[model samples]
Target: MLRDEKQYIESLRDGRVVYYRGDKVKDVTTHRALRAAVNHASLVYKWQADDDKRGLTVYKDPENGDVSSFFKIPRSSDDLIERFNLIYQTTRFGRGTFNIIKAIGSDAIFALMLVTRRIDSATGSKYAERVTRFYKNVIKNDPAIAVAQTDVKGDRLLRPSEQPDPDMYVRIVERRKDGIVVRGAKAHTTQGPVSNEIIVLPTRAMTEKDADYAVAFAVQANAPGLKMISKPERAAEAAMNDEWFVTGKENVETESITIFDDVFVPWDRVFLAGEWQFAGSLAVMFPTYHRFTAISYRAGIADMFIGLGKLLAEYNGVDDKSHIRRDVVELIKYKEMLRSTAISSAMMADLDTETGIVIPNKVLTNVGKLIANESYMDVVKHLVDIAGGLAATLPASSDFNNPEEKVYLEKYLIGKKGTNAVERARIISTVKEIISSFGALYTAAMLHAEGSIEASVLELYRSYDYKDSKKLAMYASGISEKL
Candidate 1:
């Protein structure tokens, strides 16, 4: 695929209806709230054209024999491994900045490819053909895309059909001769404002009565009647890690409450329509692939935490301490755990053999994500612990740059005997920015990005191979003669 970074930026000037901070943003590419994410996305596109990652980022699509980014349907274990490598390599460029968030849209399409085929088998619908066409269009166009999988359900305990406010969940209100009209809202949609396209999917299982809600479609991000709202980054967030941090102005991840006010979707673009039974299929399948992406990209996150933690330890002159060394070791173990699980998930991937779609090993994908969610807080805790109070009480970057304040601040803040004040302050400043700027946002994202922690646990319980465990236990206790 051609990586048209400049074109991608210029295309954002289109009148995408985006509301942020009580006002409509004129242009997301230049808007303070979304510019960072735009640039972050640009890097991914740029990497596709750059010469640095020759075989890693660029690959020939085995199916079509065209060279493109590895974000495509994996036809085999090799393809899955390639996807993992590309994601890991790209992610390490930023601390999960242009991470799973951008690429999962394609994964959604791959999920849809398999699910629609299943639907075709069950109901004889030609939705799978439409999805295949859409996939081709996506690969050819090379557009930046975002996926909205979560709906703004009014009542947390109720299903979409049970909601008093039917519009709380995205649903088709009118099935026109030309297409369908949908109205509802999706909250916490990442990269909502600036993407070239938005792929919408049903959030959960649906019954026959919920057919209207069981719809999947793609629309132009600047489509009429579609609105996106994003919150502003804190001043502290942008001030630190200007280039690498997603919370920074030049590289941020955006989440918004996206509203579909009677947005019309043409029939050709509709991947799922009134297919209630298969709603859960898309819901399950999409996340399975997405979490695999999450697990792979998290390797980069672990690397960041490890590097920073070790640096903070060395800067603090506590590198020799037993506890500090132990913490660093813990960070390394966690990093390898994430990376190894991701690799295994790819290596042990499953195939919808006939469809040529490679699905991730559900157990490993979910387990990896679950472990990452569980341990993320502790990993950050170790980082914070090693950094000491300096991470908190550090002076602002502006103060350090000030001619008058530089000498006094730097002289007092020199961390170790050998390290200069500037070097010590610089290290602490970096730690300070990353932890403080994007701390809460990154924390919340790590907790619930792919899905909630409880949801991951449930998926693991439901998909895990428990038969072997049960048989082993039964034989050991003499509960059964043979497993």
Candidate 2:
């Protein structure tokens, strides 16, 4: 079912325990700090209801009527390409901020579908059946979801069970006949306060000794004993400004430290209980789907950067300068390079014969994500260079609003030939929001969001075809004679 914006907002009124700034939030949908995020997340529903964009956000499922395009599983390369378009366009719609409320949850669901099939095939378990049923319910209700995968490890060198504090990682503390009780916490649970459900996955591979920790399941965001302590909103002060672009609600996002204190998950909701061996497979498979989503959204953000650079350059009367043109071209190259990797990843996808699900090319996806992670700074550097020093030291909206200060700012801030002072200041304010205030978090997210730069580097080494390269080197160097 495709829920409209009002229905989506009302859904979060459930009695969930959420804290912000050490105070219990009475209503997330109406709270000052959280309302922007809720509104940002509701864009999915808004787009789905719009006749012009309905095709991009949703599709007719003969069995389920109209469902979100997010829940559609990819069976062929065309389907994967469609998935790419949905993600890319939605991020652009959100003003370069990807709404993970559905995109991320679906990424987890896709990974779960693929891994559970392998587990059931090897052990004759009915895990696959449970996942399908849960997936169907998600589609029918169109509930917003948040994925909680990163565990807060007390010590970097220790495993889940080996931690000085066992609760450092979320684990099954007790096994009841009807369900299992989970305890511990997940950090960086993006959009947790606004989501209806929270899907949990193992943060890393497990061993026989870590059987209790190798669990994957879904639970209500308001489940008994579950608590979400949310981080403060980013650029809160700037969002209050009267500037056009910087004040949009769609630019906000919220994350939380979600704690599960003896939370119970019924057997029906538990997808993996003690399958220690397949834990790593589930951990790795999720990022394969998620990194593709990452690169897609990053492409949209790149588009924004490209536009911002050009707009600022034109405002500063430097659009025709050769060096400025070169930098702009570099930004264009950065965007297209990330985009090409996404297209290549989809086109070179592999079909999982057992389940008939098409998996994006793993190596190419990582390569794309790596480029997005590493080259983001260069994107920022180029934008800052194009916009000049005003990006960092622009006068606040308050200054522009004061009649006494407005007179001076009006005359002094004017730019180029046709632009007014207020117009130039607004443009510079938008750039400030991106490059300095909220952009600090955004810059870090690009490097560490899906996984770290090191994580992608490690995956590339593990998955790339080094043996063929080695053989080619041997042939070229005449080392074959020794063999």
Candidate 3:
């Protein structure tokens, strides 16, 4: 069953130690930096329950008659496509922004379930069973989860075990009769503050020397000794400028430095314990599934960029300008490119016999993500060109409230004869968000979101089958005979 907004909000009071700006926050539902995002997360829950969205967001489990979200284990290509639509709809709901913390949880669990069985094959371990049990626990509880990837490597020159400071990457510190205690931190944990669980996985492949670092587990977000030093991300907009700015996006997601201070993991919760061989599998599969989802959701953001760029050109009376038309066309081309690439990737997906989950095609998936990560900055560049510099010098929300300033500011700021002063102010304020530091930083994050550009290139290079191309070239050049 889908949890309501109220249930999700009230759950935040369960003693999660969340700190922001060097201060502790008792309840995220009411905190200044967290309230809006918490509410936004709540809408995800509410959307599942909404009658109009039920067909798209909620599904009936086949084995058990329980209500489930499309975020559950996808059994076939149809299920994967449903997830694609969910990504598009959710991004549209937030008006171009995608709070992807939930996507991380679902994608991780889906990939983990498959990879653990592979681990079982390589090593005679019951890791797959443990992961299955954990899967049932999460579905029954349906807790919001934040994935803790990317470790804070103190030195780029050293491996996890070779680090001068052993705690640089999260690793098992002590072994107990029943479980293990882990001590370390994970950086850039998106949506860490508002979540109910934190799923910890390896950041890289590990060797036997790095056995302690080759661990995977799930723990409560408010577990003993757990601390989240959070940095919230909020889209800035003038309070008096635009209703869309004020109402559409109030609270945004957060990323945090999550520290595990010798946190305990019970036997039931531990999925991988010192299984060094499977570390590489975990590293590759988790992000592969994540990148598959990234391309789908990011396309919607690209669409929003294109739509806004076109609107700005029209309002600025430059729609007829050759360059402005070309800019908007380029934006549209990128958005459609991402969308088509993702769909193509999904259409030719493969299924795992053990987990029965459909996986996106590797080459097209990487290409789609590469498109968004590589060109989003260019998307921003084109939007800025169309909107012009007024986005930065626009009057503040306060000026519109002052009677004397309101008359003069609106009169001068109004664009063309067709648009009004308030309309132009609202448009300018919206444009400000796209060109601001916050906007560019988010776009920049996409480059290294799933992995860096080099990583994606490597994956594409390895996954491609160039044997036929090479053969054709040899025959054409007379290097090989037809016989």
Candidate 4:
């Protein structure tokens, strides 16, 4: 049941409660503030429906007909590598922005599928069956999903149950015969307002006392008591229309602070309830797949940066300069380093024997993500250097349009011989957009999104085989022989 863009757009008119700029959005699909993001999200469906892109975006399932490749669980390294290519190509299609509408949702589903199976095997619970049913429905309906995991913690030092305000973390406030009621808010929920569903997961490990917080479930985006307060789009309304890179809404992303004001989740939709022990496992498993997605998409974005830098050099008539060539090489190194790590992570995939799901190498995935997180600003720096002061000083497009100002801008803004002012301005505008306020939001996301830099560092340290490294060091130093 592959959905097209029209169906995906029509699904969002479901009376979801969404607020933006202090006003209740009448319809997210049409609201000025959110429509661009909605359109951006619709590309996931558009790609699936396009004849040329169909093969890359979806696969024909013998049992289910056409299913999104995102929903296909990776069974081997080849499957994982294919998934990487799908993400990379799609990110490039979006003009360097990764669509989270499906990528993130599928990440959560995969983690849920793997973790539930383990829990059910150990406890004889029916969680695995429930998750399977939910997953089947997801593939059948092809709904866009938004994952809400990061709680708006009130105090950093305190645990969930120890918080002065108990509702700081999403928790099961009441258990009913048919379902559970959840109350809390998750911050930085990407594309929540436009998504068809929201999947919730525990943010951290829990204890017996924190059992209530160890809850995971899915609810419709327009479910009763659910609310999404979206952050304003980073690009100004004027800029969206004026900037070459920002025009057409091709490269936009949105985030929301999703609120679950006692939202109800049916038992079938509840994957984890009061299972404090397994909460950490699910929390960790999600990032394992998501960071791999992150690095893959970042590689695509790095490719864009590399191209932008070369264009800047060519336009500046410095393409032959040794320093310019060196900078371009550095950008290539950054791009391929991330791309190669993603490939290695997939090639060194780990198989969950019980579930037959291929998991990306945890250490390599984290290492790649950490590199992306730490080095993104440097990528920006290199491009900014190549683009020159014109990247920042270029006049607004409106000024360029004015008859009085057009002549001066045209005569003064010309680049290398044979290149017109407009072309040079467009390239500089793109570089400016990448380092502008909009690009700042993207920069902050690189540091914080998909878990923080420290989170990846911790995961890499934890997943690495320290004992083996210690043994090798001991043998090299003759300590092993002494023993």
Give the best candidate by TM-score. Answer: 4
- Best to worst by TM-score, what's the order? 4, 2, 1, 3
Residue-level lDDT tens digits of model 4 in 1-483: 889999999999999999998999999888775888888899999999898999999998889999999898899999999999999999899878888899999999999989999899888889889889999999999999999999999998999999999999999999999999999999999999999989999999999999999999999999999999988886645456675657335557788999999998999999999989999999999999999999999898899889889988998899899988888888898899899999999999999999999999999999999999998888787888888898888887777888999999988888788878887888788777777747767788888888799999999888898887788889889889632
Better of 1 and 3 by TM-score: 1
Instruction: Estimate the TM-score for candidate 4.
Output: 0.97
Local accuracy of candidate 2 as per-residue lDDT tens digits, 1-483 = 789999999999999999999999999988876888898899899999898899999988889989999999999888888988898888888877888889999999999999999999999999999999999999999999999999998898998889999999899999999999999999999999999999999988999999998999999989999999998775654575544445344557788999999999999999999899999999999999999999888888888888888887888899999999988988998889888888899999989999999999999999999999999898888988998898888878888888999999998888898887787787777778876557767877999999999989988999998887788789789988532
Estimate every model's Cα lDDT from 0 to 1: 0.82, 0.89, 0.80, 0.89
lDDT of 1 by residue, 1-483 (tens): 455689879988998998878998888887765777787787777777777865566667766554456556688888888888888888887554544445878888889899988999999888888888887877777778899989988988988888998998999999999899999999888887878889999999999989999999999998899999886666324654343222375557778899999999999889889989999989999999989888888887788778888877886789999999988988898889988888899889998976988898999999899988999888887877888888888776667778999989877887667777766766666677667777778788889988989999999888988889999899999998897
RMSD of each candidate? Answer: 2.0, 1.7, 2.1, 1.5
Q: Which parts of model 1 have CA positions greater than 4 angstroms off?
A: 62-67, 235-237, 240-247
Model 2, 127: alpha-carbon shift in Å? 0.8
Model 4 is weakest, by summed lDDT over 10 consecutive residues, at: 243-252
lDDT of 1 at 145: 82
After superposing candidate 4 on the true structure, give the runs of residues whose Cα lies further than 4 Å from its correct spot: 236-248
Model 3 residue runs over 4 Å out of place are 66-68, 232-251
lDDT of 2 at 42: 90
